[model samples]
Target: MAATPALEIAPEKVAHVIIKAREYGAKVGAWNASTEEGDADEDPSAILEDFASDPTLGEIAGFIDALNDDEQANLVALAWIGRGTFEPEEFDEAVDTARSEQGNSTASYLLGLPLLSDYLEEGLEKLGFSANDVESDVL
Candidate 1:
């Protein structure tokens, strides 16, 4: 079997990102957009509504932005690996590509992926890390 790839980004950090990403991904776009306001008891679905000004988005983005450049690159590479763009053995290549191909903000680029949480989790698993275990610890 191929050797497990090492990760520059800590599993704990990645787990944190996964948790936040899951929260962000669970949001629905303005499901309660109608001006009709209702009591929480009447419309609990409001909690799932995602407004353009939602802080969750900013929170996750800021968390990702705080990481150094190498961490950001490794993050992108991990996502790529999870998404099947590269094999686990190609980790270094993936990281190198991530660095060279960086254009927009890493946070922006990553946040744009609807399946960011899944991809990251899968990437961690592929690298022989247990995302679930790390995530539980993070929580």
Candidate 2:
């Protein structure tokens, strides 16, 4: 079947989000990979402290929080599309639902979802957009 038309949010805007989600995913992975044990010279609590204080995590959250309502809704819709909650043909309906359901705190909501980066990337693919350029640009 032919791919769905472009998103109201624009591929570039979605790509911007894809980049941030990727960075956020990497940080989360690193934090999870780190050992719980502390070095002889360091306090054990410091590990958790550093994880909590990670600037990259904060940047990701801040960037999402900075998005306007429409942008945030678009992100949610894209994720839903990627995650199979909606098909590509249902894109407009998905976006409409996202806008009505999102209310406030979209950043927190989106960040709370696991595999967010994967979902966003898949969503773009559903719309016939490749994430290769976005990934390269983010690197």
Q: How many clashes (backbone N, Cα, C below 3 Å) per candidate?
A: 0, 0
- For candidate 2, the 10 contiguous residues with the lowest summed lDDT are 43-52
> TM-score: which candidate is best?
1
lDDT of 1 by residue, 7-64 (tens): 8888899999999999999988775567444345767887777876678999999999
Question: After superposing candidate 2, which stretches have Cα over 4 Å from the reference?
Answer: 1-3, 28-50
Give lDDT tens digits, candidate 2, residues 1-139: 5547556666666676677666666542223447553343654433333355466567777877877777778889999999999999988789889988876688788877888888999998878778776566656
Q: Quote the lDDT for 16 in model 1.
A: 90
TM per prediction: 0.92, 0.74
Which residue pairs show collisions in model 2? none
Report how far off residue 16 is in candidate 1 (Å).
Answer: 0.7
Quantify all predictions' global Cα lDDT against the true fold. 0.89, 0.73
- lDDT at position 130, candidate 1: 86
